[model samples]
Target: MGPLQIKELLQQTPDGQSVTLKGWVRTKRESKNAIFIALNDGSTIHNIQAVAAPGQFSAELLLTVTTGSCLKITGQLVESQGSGQAVEVKIDDIFVYGTADVDSYPLQPKRHSLEFLREIAHLRPRTNTFSAILRIRHALAFAVHKYYNDRGFFYLHTPIITASDAEGAGEMFRVTTLDLDKLPRTDEGAINFKEDFFGREANLTVSGQLEGELGAMALSKIYTFGPTFRAENSNTTRHLAEFWMIEPEMAFFELEDNMDLAEDFIKTVITYALENCKDDLAFLENRLADEDKNKPQNERSIPLLEKLNFVVENAFERLTYTEAIDILLKSKPHKEKKFQYPVGWGIDLSSEHERYLVEKHFKKPVILTNYPREIKSFYMKLDDDGKTVRAMDVLFPGIGEIIGGSQREDNYEKLLERVHEVGIDPETIWWYLETRKFGTAPHSGFGLGFERLVLFVTGMGNIRDVIPFPRYPKSAEF
Candidate 1:
């Protein structure tokens, strides 16, 4: 009838039936009597081989067959005589939809570096590495929705443009319509945001948590999956200026219940990827293994498949932030004077400290809770001692803190006090504070950086590579 995707064709029991295939030509090899072409339609990572006899097409038509050329072919589906694939198409007719210039094309048949591929972000999807990565990314996203849906969690869509900073770090991208060349100023000489769009200062949301609490208060359990922006000037491999976050907020769930859900959620998605994305994960596993072999013996990593299985099978270590701090203070890194930021109480844990806990000491994922109130956000539930809040951070082996969440403060006065303590005006987020005043509950939630999870699952070192188009400081090209 019409065209069959290469993914579907590769799985069929070849019976020499006629079929139509449409895709880009990945590679072509010429012989005196025949020309063999590998066709890919982005339906799957595997390519289908097509054979053309001497008289099947003109010499001029044959010359157009090159990498990246789009083609439509009618052929006979027969069992392949080749080694890697199961089926091949014996072409009866061929048509070139478009042809890529071989003299100027960036993606050659040879293996290219990830850095080089990133420069050509628009075309990187056609490569085997990115193709497999994107497939796995899709699988992971599906698993996220399936896991939450199966657990009775309602998916909530919060506002992308918010008036208040949920994180309270003050690192936010302002969304304004005011002209910079000609500004409207107050009599006090400050630029008046009242003249701007929305009649008040607004920003691209750093999180959807504050609004998610309103949903959780009534719905009992709710989650958010959307894009978030940060104004941090970080250029690290683990950071992105714009990224996707999955935030799950639940009513009546404490820090312990939050940890249970987080652990289960992570394990479920990893297991789903392991079972469903076999071909893609295998390719990534092999890629990581090859890359690791080039590193020093001490810096080399375990196989990706084994690492995934390890996370699926093991129970995450749960401990208090104080306990983790104690372990770090007595750790060898501290004694040997190795850590760049020295370990002590009341100080925030650096990436080095987090990696030490998960990678070197525990050798499993860790859930650290009850962080000092000064180190955490203002919305976190205050402990009885008033010194710490019910904040939890889940740290993985390679990447440090993959999740950061807390039990939200249900008491309006305590939340207001904390807000004022953090130097944020209470009038700005009166809507969020109203939720606590009306129907308060012991609500808890966490923000999981989706790209970080993908990075961990795919064994990718750079955060930019996992996302389709990463936005970072000074780099938003394509």
Candidate 2:
């Protein structure tokens, strides 16, 4: 049989069963009579301790058993005398698969700052904190698929590179094969995109919502979970140049249906994590608590588990953008001039404003809908007042807007007009517009930034920490 995983072995009732295990050494402690090695195989947050009697292994072999070293061991499982763990491995034989240089290994057996870990992200997964985060990330991703699949939503793979900008923000990475040194130009002296690879300007997709809508139109229910790129230059705790998006588009769904789906979806996923990732979440909860001890009480976050449970158990507060703005205008922070940005009806809500609405006022997740038309995307269905659109943003505590969606404008004339008003050439997105021309049905969808969800669920303070390899401004290392 293959070597038993540490997670599996830890749960077994130790009846002197001989077992083979393989994993990396996390730490080594030497006593006068025996040596103890903490072994982990990335299966779980907890490590299994392997005890070795001195002289059972050669001194040279013992010297090779350092932190971060990979090993295979044949051992007999027995009840542990330790306080923390239930069982321990009594090492009968040990083999070093690879040795990490004691002098060069960066991850020593100690607490590491998140910033320092990011520098060595290629190897950070070996650390307990990152390993736990990655495990939770995996569980959440699996939950996302299971949740959608069980609901009869088809998984749709949208193009990573396309000619259309889904968000129309113009912040996209260009995909080009044209040689800059010998570039062809139009008579107007602009670089000729016709001479490029696709015979037109192509960019990494900023979202899959537009393509996902086409799938929804045919399939009735569709979801796209894939990498998305944005060229925004912000270096905040919440931004990433390249990230994953979870966009679900449903046909015959109105703004109310969209809101209902978003709420149920968020709650369901969080509940899954709470049930399946208890150990990892507990580790992260303690980690956050320890970190928060240094900050002011008001600045510290609610305990991670409590925050998550509160979200799962409570119903999200729903209000219109106008109502949310009114609450903010009457809030103590706004009256006392504590808000950094101005709060008004036509302005887009910033992270601070969003957090205040969720963390301070509502004390639960909030879904703010019917945003002013000018502040929202052009595809949103316009309200009768012509001043607002059927847009929704789901705001969470600690993290601001976790999900943003809208009921799409189904009328061909209004959509085309909005397209022109936004200065987008109709010819560029003729295919998307053609959907409305042929057989447009009322549809609603939302885009959930995958890293942001991971960030929230993992209780990670920075967006970069949750994603394996984070891409951001001026940094793409490993």
Candidate 3:
């Protein structure tokens, strides 16, 4: 057989079986009798011990096995005498694929801060915390596809570059190939986009929900999983310039159906991580607990595993936007002037308001619905009072709005009026507007920020820590 991965070797019975393992050396210690090495293959957080006896290899070979050294070894898997590990490899042959220069190696055996690791992102995955996070991220992604596929939702690939401003936020990154120093000008002295690559204004898509809806109109249910970009200038821990979004749109589905699916989908993904990523989650949980030791008692978050399980077991509390506003009006934070941004019926809920709803007031996940139309997008179904829309936001304890969706307006006239109200040119989104003109049904969908979900599940603080290569305001370092 080919070389066995460390994860597979660790699970098998160590009955003196010969195996070839390929991985990097995590650490090396020499005893009086033998040389002990902790080797990892990036398949699991745990490392397998490989012992090289005194005569098994030359002194030169032993000197090369340092931290970050790549190696290929053929050895016998035997029961380990070590305390933490179950199996050990008694080396027979060794090949030093690469050697790390101890003087310049960024990742040492000692603990490095997350900020320091971010600078060397190319090598950070070799660390325990990042490796575990990436593994759990993989598990969560798999569960997302599995859950949607099991429910018969067709996966749709939407265009990355689009001409329409779906969010109407106008924060899209433009996709163009034009020389700024010498640009084509129109008769009005304005730079002409007609000479550009796409022959018109185009941008990296901000959301796929608009296109996903077209697929749902025909397929009954469809979803999009891909990268989206934003040109916002915020440099907070919660913001990312580029990120992945999962949007599932369904035809003939109302706001209630959307909320139900969102809740169930989140629970299913979290449960998958709990089951398949037990070792990784356990490692992260311990890592988080260790991190909380320095924090003040009141500032420490709930235990990692307990928080995840609590979300899975409990039903999310549902309330209207008006009710939430009423609750906030009477809240101590509101009366004591603790919120930096004031809260009211017409104003959009800030992070403080959302956190209060989920963490302080309800002490659980919150599903807030019926937001004022002025505060929501133009596509949401307007209520009879014409003041609120059928929009809903799923708020978590630490992460405020993990998911936002609503039942789409099926009336062409009403939707058109909303489009005009939002100052979007009707000619630009004619295709999207046409969906309502033909056979429009009451439909709904929601967007789940994949990294934010990973952040919540892994109990990571910064959104950048959860993603592999984060693209933020002024940084795109890999």
Model 3 ranges off by over 4 Å: none
lDDT of 3 by residue, 1-478 (tens): 5677899999999999899989998999988898898999999999999998876777887888889999998889999987998999998898999999888888889999999988888999999999999999999999999999999999999999999888999999999899979999999999899999999999999999899999999999999999999999998988899999999999999999999999999999999999999999999899989999999999898888999998998899999999999999999999999999998889899998999998899999999999999989999999999999999999988779999999999899999999999999999989998999899899999999999999999999999898899998779866
Looking at candidate 2, the ten consecutive residues that score lowest on lDDT are 1-10
TM-score of each: 0.98, 0.98, 0.98
Root-mean-square deviation per candidate:
1.3, 1.0, 1.1
CA displacement after TM-score superposition, residue 458 of candidate 1 (Å): 1.0
Model 3, global lDDT? 0.93
456 in model 2: Cα distance from truth in Å?
0.6
lDDT of 2 by residue, 209-273 (tens): 99999999999999999999999999999999999999999999999999999999999999999
What are the lDDT figures for the candidates, one per model? 0.92, 0.94, 0.93
Stretches off by above 4 angstroms in model 2 are none
In model 3, which residue pairs have backbone atoms overlapping below 3 Å?
Answer: none
Cα-lDDT of candidate 2: 0.94
